[model samples]
Target: MAAVPLRRPLDAETVVVPVGQVFVIPERCKGCRFCIEFCPEQVLVESDRMNAKGYRYPVVADGKERACVNCGFCRLICPEFAIYTEEIR
Candidate 1:
């Protein structure tokens, strides 16, 4: 059997990937689908939860916790102002 080598990042110590802390007001979301549809990273997905308005909200996709880039696109695009992101410094 051929052995597969595990490759690691050469500059893992110095390279910093910006992470975004995503926040969503579940009750404020009216199933607008802006955040889930327009994320440049495509990190948001449809959540199986329903809020007070009986509408599905956006949630981070499985295994994509660190995918957001803190671009503020979701907040800007959301008409309900239900979602926002803060950059993790």
Candidate 2:
């Protein structure tokens, strides 16, 4: 066989991609759907039930887990201040 070059394996010093899960507060949400529309990852979903304000709030889907950047934009848009993001690690 002809001689071939081999690629080196990745080491600890290599850059690692970061991933995290998004969390939503059903009780705190006012059902404004701000997070749902504003989320860059499109992870947020509308809940079946409404919040204290009788408005449908945004919620994170259980099955469709996504890597969140934790930008905190949802928290800022939320009038109720119900949504919050945290790092997985």
Candidate 3:
């Protein structure tokens, strides 16, 4: 007699979704909060450190760095073109 194999159930909560990669050019940023305010995922925040121009720049928030959804709102809202996102693929 042959034995049957057992399978475990899949859980939706355990699935991991792919997010976008976010890049920030601190030197080009002018301490503007447009990116932070317009980000759909709210993944960016003002960094504690200042840039070369003595301006606070946006960075991936702690514990939420991988939350970006590849949305270009941050890039579009950035008047200085300091921030952008790439799809994770």
Candidate 4:
């Protein structure tokens, strides 16, 4: 009789992300809100009005540090790619 192959179960673990931060460039930002919606932490929010180009720009609102996880979700999702992250030294 042929021996049966054994299968191993995958282990579940939480992803540990490094302490990262993001910055929004007013000049580069087109205020598309792509970062605001895409950000998992909801760190970015729409300001009172739009930018010079008539677009809603994103700004860090509420929690200053805890809010933004620096996942770079907004940066990637943004069509303009205006979102940028900075590492704390």
TM-score of every model versus the real structure: 0.79, 0.64, 0.76, 0.64
lDDT of 1 by residue, 1-89 (tens): 98889888999999777899999988888997978988999999988989887899999999989899899999999999899999996
What lDDT tens digits, residue by residue, belong to model 4 across residues 1-89?
99888874454255444556777767667766777776777787887776777777787786766556566677778777677877562
For 1-89, candidate 3 gives per-residue lDDT tens digits of 78877765577578565688989999999987988887778899999999988999999999887788886888888999898899885
Of 2 and 3, the candidate ranking higher by TM-score: 3
lDDT comparing candidate 3 with the true structure: 0.86
lDDT of 2 at 19: 55
Clashing pairs in 3: none
Q: By summed lDDT, which 10 consecutive residues of candidate 4 come out lowest?
A: 8-17
The TM-score leader among the candidates is 1
lDDT of each: 0.91, 0.72, 0.86, 0.71
Tens-place lDDT per residue, model 2, 1-89, is 98788875678468554556566667776666778887877877887888676777776777656556676788778888778787664
Model 1 spans > 4 angstroms off: 1-16
Instruction: After the best TM-score superposition of candidate 1, give how far the Cα of residue 2 lies from its true spot, in angstroms.
Output: 28
TM-score of the candidate numbered 1?
0.79
